[model samples]
Target: MDIDRYLGPGHRTAALVTSHGLAVADAAVRLAEAERIHEEKEELAGTLTRRWGTPCHLGLQTVRLRTGTEEIPEPWAGLSLRVGDVYLWQVAEQGRWVALGVADLDPDDEIQLLLVVTDTDPP
Candidate 1:
């Protein structure tokens, strides 16, 4: 899965795909704990349509937060993300490779959080 575009300039995005099935709410809680503003209304795009392909589900979510007037931290300081901006995260998994993307974000933007896996990994 390619996630380069969603990551803002000069910022880095990281994700972890696990074999365990994590509830959507449970993952959202983790994101909130990381200080990401979780918005559940947004529609996340991307899926495997092939008949014989593994079945994977995609979760789209956005988060907004204030960094205060103080200078933004390194890596995130120069990025375009702001207090009201919404950053996109993609959680995709078919079998065991569930991918998670995190970064500074803007509102209402579309991003691809790709997850590719085999039949062994269930959504």
Candidate 2:
């Protein structure tokens, strides 16, 4: 249902934006979480969706892996990925792999994406 009457679609430009995990460039993590929510939303929502007429698209997650005594690898082991002034640490290890949505895709390499800034934390 296109709500063009009540809310018209418009064009806008953004110099920067980091919401709903839009700053994350980890394709695997983003996909995993996106899929996880897709499968679990209905189950988790219970009667919330039915009553509200909208599915709650949840985001962000953290979990611990039973690695025992094994050593972690680079990128994943460091616990964070930094882009510009943003530092995105914490992943499947620290039980915090969030999907920063898709900030911007590379024109040359479509697969490459520029995730959100994570250097500073919210006060």
Q: How badly does each model clash, as a count of residue pairs?
A: 7, 15
Per-candidate local distance difference test:
0.30, 0.28
Top lDDT model? 1
Candidate 2 per-residue C-alpha lDDT over 12-115 given as tens digits, one digit per residue, 9 for 90 to 100: 11122222452344676555544553344334334433433443232222111312344533222122222111223323343432222221222222211222
Over 8-62, each residue of candidate 1 has an lDDT whose tens digit, in order, gives 4333433222212223336464445334212221222223223223423232222
The TM-score obtained by model 1 is 0.22
Query: In candidate 1, which residue pairs clash?
Result: 17-98, 37-63, 86-106, 86-107, 87-105, 94-121, 95-121
Q: Show the lowest summed lDDT stretch of 10 residues, model 1.
A: 114-123
Native-to-model Cα distance after best TM-score fit, residue 93 in candidate 1, in Å: 26
